[model samples]
Target: MSPGYLPFKDALDLPAFFCENCGFWQRHFTRPDSCPLCIDSRHVMPQRGWHFHTVEEARDRYPCHWAEVEPGVWRFFNDPIDGIGSSGYLIQTAAGNLAFEGCGVYSEDALALIATLGGVQVLAASHPHSYGAIWQLQDRFDPELALHPGDLSWSGALCVSWPFDDVLEPLPGLSLHLTAGHFDGHTVLYDRGRHILFCGDCLKFELDPADARRATTISAHKAFVRGIPLTPAELRRYRDVFAALDFTQTWTPFEQAANSGRREALTLIDTMMATRPHAYPVPLETL
Candidate 1:
């Protein structure tokens, strides 16, 4: 059953709100006048003002789509994410399915498919921008919600059960790593068995045209639209965590996985540091 407008929290008629600019799905009944993420300089607040969608409006606007990008790895999202941030992921695991991030839109079909795969036992995100319709998922699955306490200030109302700090292996072969630069608690999911790193917002990328799912340029950023570069210490922290990983491929919130290895990952950081400290990303041509 997809979310409809009728059973809203109260008669105030505010229902749940979604920030179309940054994809922050706030489920609480109280309507906060402005989106907290949009107010921050790290994220650009559209001049047109805060664009919000009610549950019913969002479901009608964004259609549901899902695919197994790789074995045991699935991505489900609605189109026109645009600047709303990245899509959510459903990673099938032996312990249980882990739902990382939540699609801002809801679909009955997506919900039913997930049920057959065993409803999500764990739910988490790299940051608040990707915390789409998590409340809907929490309501439906009652999964164990997790968030690094660092981003807890931004996570509204959701009950967090298993919060991970530096590292966590909540499920077999699936791990979470904190590499805070984009935000104080920006994290990445590492699937050890597949040698893939879910980059989250920790890194920015442009997918190659020849190979729609591949990336030729990978860059680091404190904020992409603002063109802010991370401080040396923050970038170093990212390097350290990624160095420990043995991933040959990477995936961002909006883009598909790219054939980038650990060496290319480190070189991007090194190139950024040694030469252009102020440059958003050292530019793919130089890398």
Candidate 2:
């Protein structure tokens, strides 16, 4: 079957290849020879061989459900699932509901919850791996799945591609900044109205999340390591892009979030680059 061809009913049941290396889900009638997203050393390949899992295979063990992460934000997570622990967010906005990422795994409960919170109007991902079960999501919800023009080939289906010159305003007060790094079209959603930055692995947070003082500790090292480290040029460009935004709380696809204000988050990036020196360093010229 061609990509994005699954019917709404069949989509939720279609078999998809879940790449453990990059945490991406691409649905196809037959598995590809190799994971497309992992080809450029963007992700590590499995030593044993390529492994694929169907939605049905995982639903029993890793049930899908939703949780309220913040006042208006809800997180959809799967328990006991293999590969990277992937989570997607649904944020309530005046314009409509916005989802940060997608999970290949879906459930009736999740669909119900999404409907309860005003069905998602737009679903955007930061990178290819974060595309989640985009094909399925499109079939089921028919929401606009935003992708970067540069990463279109990385997509399994025909995605709604956007250009960097034109900013995306999914909602009245929310905007998505398509920055370069992990992928040429990597993005981070910023809610200008509430000062909340939804970073989809663009700005990674490093800390013992289990620690009680994780938020207050400024020593936590947070770098933009999606598949490869950011180049000095890309780092400087991203730094300036973020430097222009004012956000209080920033959240990622993983379990890391920075609540110490945007200034502090920016400072941490500066500190990490200064200390690491090798991977990321202060740039003399901006891109």
Candidate 3:
């Protein structure tokens, strides 16, 4: 613990605690003895050792800021302060704005921008790692923050009120669907009208072959994904899960958007399974 660090007991009532080594906030509950995100190889741990930081210290070190990446959508990023380099977004809709992704950084400028665009009505994270400085945002904005029950332990005290079901329709065209891949609780936000899916890391945009050079590698699927390695049966199940969706494009935690539609997305999944037959073999029934 550092000088500004608040003991986990003190932060038990807060939404999350910052793991200095992991450089991200984990929802606090009983002051976790260790960070779940870091201990898991998916996120990787810090070299030095484990340490904790207060939300205040993180905000002071790295102030939150934003850039409008698309119509009615703002992208937020900060490096030096936000050590994990996670990016979040503010999506404006007819009903209200949705803060997607939690970066443990808040700034007055961000507040002003939200005020100007209409304050966020709901808050969410793509996965455990993006659960940034949510407490700070919640404290300042007072929005209905939604956390998946599967990931609740990570969201320490911040008074998690809204737990999501398998499917949640916060706005008219906006729906959040729980899709397992990276984590059992991983979710994706679907914009029905636009046919755009905010898939976090569960489904990622892959580079287009048209844009690839001779050095470009090709694959059946065109999405970048990371998580616990899946067994062939598990991978096929996941493919079936995503294949049922009716979406034209997918946006991930990273900036790129995969214009490939549901067919392409499914192809990518099948291709991934084929390439790693030993690890992800197709079942005989399906064959």
Candidate 4:
């Protein structure tokens, strides 16, 4: 069986709501135009996504908890409102453990938890915006940094940084690919042993338990609505880059896991490429 889903209330103090139209839940807010997911516009609106484990309660919930999703694969959800934003993960390998993405806050307890496992050897972030507490993690583990060269400017004043080239062989079978969609240096990790792809925010998790058995794909629609840095043309190019990967299951740090068990990653890439461009305020009521 796959991992089960839990509400944000059980995990964090954040408000959540379920969208009847898409069957996705988002955060509840006084502003109708607020988007809790992308945290941008009302067109995308915030829907309730699966809540993972967290630490603390009330205003004290600055740091969140981590979970072991699959053997050797662990995920950490950071508390957003506290200003320590985005989720990250730790993957155990024969050499040592590797951490992907940065969290809002890194505590001694969290560092100890990672050290107790096997100790981290490499720290990587998919994009600059997701570079939560990378500097702190690096100071703790002092591991090799993995990031896209295109986003080097984003890592301002960081003493240690490395460019993500073709494929990185941090371990025997694990490879890190710089997909370059959501950001110039966005990355995804492919574990040959598990055939799982850790896509750091390049894709959003669309939750539908009833269709969990089927392959799931993300929509560029949200990106379109938010007026993100990427244009439709640029997005299409990024989609093409993601099309080259071979992954069975896709996991996002804070959302539901997608079963790309059968379909190729190219299928979703093609879908996004073919969709027609449109303006925001997409009448979510109609979608």
In terms of TM-score, the best-performing candidate is 1
Write model 1 residue lDDT over 110-136, tens digit each, in one string: 888888888888888888777878777
Structural RMSD, model 3: 7.3
By TM-score, is 2 or 3 better?
A: 2
lDDT of 4 at 208: 55
Worst 10-residue stretch by lDDT in candidate 2?
A: 278-287
- What candidate 1 gets wrong by more than 4 Å, as runs, is 1-15, 82-85, 276-286
Instruction: Evaluate model 1: give its TM-score.
Output: 0.90
- Which candidate comes out best when scored by lDDT? 1
Q: After superposition, how far is residue 73 of candidate 2 from its true place, in Å?
A: 0.5
Point out the worst 10-residue segment of candidate 4 by lDDT: 18-27
For candidate 4, the per-residue lDDT at 23 reads 16
Model 3 misses residue 204 by how many Å? 4.1
Cα lDDT, all candidates: 0.77, 0.64, 0.63, 0.55
At residue 191, give the lDDT of candidate 4: 72
Comparison by TM-score, 1 against 4, better one: 1
Off by over 4 Å in 4: 1-61, 79-84, 209-217, 221-240, 261-265, 275-287
- How many clashing residue pairs appear in each of the predictions shown? 0, 0, 15, 6
- In candidate 4, what are the lDDT values of residues 15-65, reduced to their tens digit? 433222111223234212422334423234334533322222321445457
Screening candidate 4 with a backbone cut-off below 3 angstroms (N, C-alpha, C), the clashing residue pairs are: 25-47, 25-48, 26-46, 26-47, 26-48, 84-104
TM per candidate comes to: 0.90, 0.81, 0.76, 0.66
Candidate 3 lDDT over 1-287, as tens digits, reads 01223344455454555777555665555345677777775666667777766656666777666777667878776657534566677888999888887655766777777788998788887667666766666777778877677777766645465778787877678777776556667777777777767776654333445652111111221112223455566567556656767887666655435344566556656766777622222222232
